[model samples]
Target: MSLGDDHGYGDSARTDASGEYGGTGTTRTRLPESGPYGGARRGRSSSRSLVTVVGVVVLLIAAIAFANRGDGDSGGAPDTADKPDTAPTAASGTDPVKSSTAGVPTGYSQSEQGAQSAATNYAVALGSTGMFRKADRHALLDALFTRDAAARLKGPMDQAYSTGFLDSMGLDENGDPPEGSTFVSRVSPMGTTVEEYTDTTAKVAVWYVGLIGMSGERSTDPVTSTWKTWTFDLSWTDGDWKIVEDAQTDGPAPVPGDDRAATSDEISKAIEEYGGFTYAR
Candidate 1:
């Protein structure tokens, strides 16, 4: 599927792997100017207002559900929720190659399962805090994408995380978090599905929850979670599956739970103490 079909907030669309950067009359995925989810940052007032409205709507729905629970209407459809059918612990019957390039898992087998693995891992990399830093972002692009795609994206990606953008997010010119603040940007894949597969090309969708923003006592943008589905078009290139193009959508988000939000210090400590894993099916 073409990446440009949708352009919602936090969405990105890129040219195909074979397309040249500004030479083949093709468009590249434009990263947003602000926000940790790769979108133009919203004003605090607007964001807070939207959140309040959504919270009220959710509470009203819950209250209505509770009031109607005993009305004897038990024929409602099941909540499929667009989640994966299999459990996370179930084996996929594939042994992933324990190889990596520049800290990203690599050497995936040329199969549908391998494509799913690669897509999910690449999603994590693309949504990472490293993407906010120039050097680390360049390294990740080089490692996770085709050579042409990496070269094509460097300029635009750099602009997206420009100095002005960093300052807007309270980061320094070097994209470092402010002292006493911990910047958070992490992607946790809930599941993956292969949309279409061929011998040399595969398209996979990764449903994930991402945590982003800064954690600190004086932070204006406290860490928040977002749900999104990242669709990757991958090609088996140079002995590994590399990203060709990709797109993202809001989500098939589940109902919000009643868990309390953690403190900034708690979030900072947890981020430092917990290590991420190399996801393999």
Candidate 2:
């Protein structure tokens, strides 16, 4: 797994110990070898959209099933014509932690909600601008992953974020953008689901949208949006959840809205002004 800027987004076509992001219909098993930005090579953008639609349908069915078993009572008959607005069915009444370890959220509960929280927070951290730097990246992985997983991933990850990759992103050897340039790479979790759960282990999938690129007049790689589902296999270790394994797949994206894309300056300013959240489910 590489800590490079191009690691998490599904734009790549290659896979490694680091997670892979697939396109709409096809699975991207690895990072792209084409260039530093991993420009989209898949000719099937429409097919990828269809796959996202199908994935959404599957998630809806699962959500319905889960809702039916709430409070130990069978949910009432389905009302297709008068379906309620989409919203979270269960609320744990728990607030997110106000503290963090090395800028990563901690203190998750031992329930499914906690698992989802851990996955979403981890997604954000893994997708941040900090991943481009070796020192920050190492600290992040150490904080989020189990000791064994971190140890196994360190070497491959270091290799992935080699000098060549950083140079490709127009960053200096230290992974810093040129003066007056802002490198933006951030992940925003839209929703989360618990795929599997037990007392000690949990599998959670975070549906998120990410922004990646350098925002500056001299920048060759411009910021762009990507939708993906990041699945994390977590262990309840010590007093917090830690990742043992993780993977990314193409999105469960909804149809695009009529919103216009923001300008580079606007994106850069927003990134600087806004702080990330400690997401809770």
Candidate 3:
């Protein structure tokens, strides 16, 4: 996926696939009131029913008693002797970066958690409204990318955010929406993964849902959502993680839900009122 496909941040020539971001009835069987098996079978069935009811009651009582036990004072805690040493997954409990460079998060730790955090934050920055503006976009790239990468990408990135491209998205040549219209290009990362990592370099992926387009009564390009996975190759340099390369792929998008599309007014109001998050793994 190109950045333009989600945020209008990349070359518009590379249009990605716009695929359609592609119940139980219970029945009860009743026992026969009468059958050829006779009254003896009926008596046995009644006994079995009584036994099942009694067993259920006993189990319920036992469960309640177990739940009410003391917390290991009298050896009443649940048996955890065979529990595994490591958790299958867990959070690192690190707070997101409180400081940023040119509005991009910086100063991540040297751990896997930090790598994931950096990747997620980079995805958000690369997919933000600032990326559509020349000066702000250059600043963002300089702050988030390594020096070499930024130099190599400067010309291409400028070309990608061209005036013609901005015009196609209902924006003026400067990447600003017309008066009374709101241009929305925001990325919210759902989760992050460190696909590969080392002390000096790491490859991370962030799965995210993005909102893009112009929101206004007169807007032809209404705001819409796209799901994508953004992967970044990062290097630990100058005591911070900086992106060396970045790429995006069309999602593992979920089936569309039944919710009605919100009105332009509602969309504009929501964007204005709700702030974005400082994401962490």
Candidate 4:
């Protein structure tokens, strides 16, 4: 069966016809009423990642649960009292940091521009396929989050991305798809805006488009794209911006396009050839 959303860790529900991992499940399961992620099931048309902030990241929906821990500024955020209604589209000309930590961009300036850059990069990292794997996920958390936040989340996040969950998404214990299939999960940032800013803390929102699903002739889950707004509450810590906590919501998505879907081979080739960029203000 095919899953939806590009958050990549996997979140779709369907009872298997043959009671196997990749079985042809005809009986569609439904999400629980208690919470958004509890047994949650979403249609193909759902606009964004399926996770909620209250608790539990059941698949593509991961809300890092670092509550009230970051942001030392006590002045309180004003309701855009002195800020512009919208940010300009022009480039800031300041170059992005050339250094990297655990393959993530690092060394951001302690400014509004730096916060935006941190948020954008963090969004991409969180929405990637690596979040599905054990070692990679830990490394990513280390690079993207504050020390305390990452330590608190590692155990819970591990539980959320369990072996059963991986099987449901047609991925092995290593977070790999079938032998011949290519699992595609990527996030491309559209733009960013600062919701609130301070010397020690900042809230930034990133509008992005994501691709998820498996690409192969034998694959049932062909790659599909979705739009989302991922907002991060960042704290300037350890010489750079680090995530305290984050949440995601459905877009501000534009109208659907009329273009035809590309083949699995084509999609695989394109992904292999076209590398992503290091985003900055």
Best by TM-score: 1
- What tens-digit string does per-residue lDDT give for candidate 3 at 1-281? 12444333322222111110000111111111111000210112235556678779999999999999775587656688987543224456678576889977788888778888888888778677886788887898688877766655556556555676668767688878899999887888878777789999998878888777778999987777777777777889998898766656667776554456899999999999998866665
> Which one wins by TM-score: 1 or 2?
1
Q: What lDDT tens digits, residue by residue, belong to model 4 across residues 1-281? A: 11123133223321222111112332121211111112222344433333232224443243333543467767677577786787667658898787888788999999999999888887777667787788998898788877766665666556556787777666799888898788887888899999999999998988987777778898876677777676778889989998876655667767554355799999999989998878889
Per-residue lDDT over 35-85 for candidate 2, one digit per residue giving the tens place of the 0 to 100 score? 322334222334556767888999999999898766744667666887643
How far residue 38's Cα lies from its native spot in candidate 4, in Å, is: 13
Q: Alpha-carbon error at 222 in model 1, in Å?
A: 0.2
lDDT of 2 at 178: 92
Question: How big is the positional error of residue 246 in model 3, measured in Å on the Cα after superposition?
Answer: 1.1
Best model per lDDT: 1
Candidate 1 TM-score to native: 0.75
Name the candidate, 1 or 4, with the larger TM-score value.
1
Residue 211 of model 1, lDDT score:
80
Query: What TM-score should be assigned to candidate 4?
Result: 0.72
Q: Judged by lDDT against the true structure, how good is candidate 4? A: 0.66
Candidate 1 yields a Cα-based lDDT of 0.71
Q: Candidate 2 overall Cα lDDT vs. reference? A: 0.69
Q: Write the per-residue lDDT of candidate 1 for residues 1-281, one digit (tens) a residue.
A: 11111211123323333221222322234454346664322333335567779989999999998987775657776688987665354447676667887678889989878898898888777777777778888898889888887887787666656687778777898879988999887888888888889999998989987887889999998887767787888989999998887767777767555456799999999999998877777
> After superposition, which runs of candidate 1 have C-alpha atoms over 4 Å from their true positions?
1-30, 38-93
Sort by lDDT, top down from the best: 1, 2, 4, 3
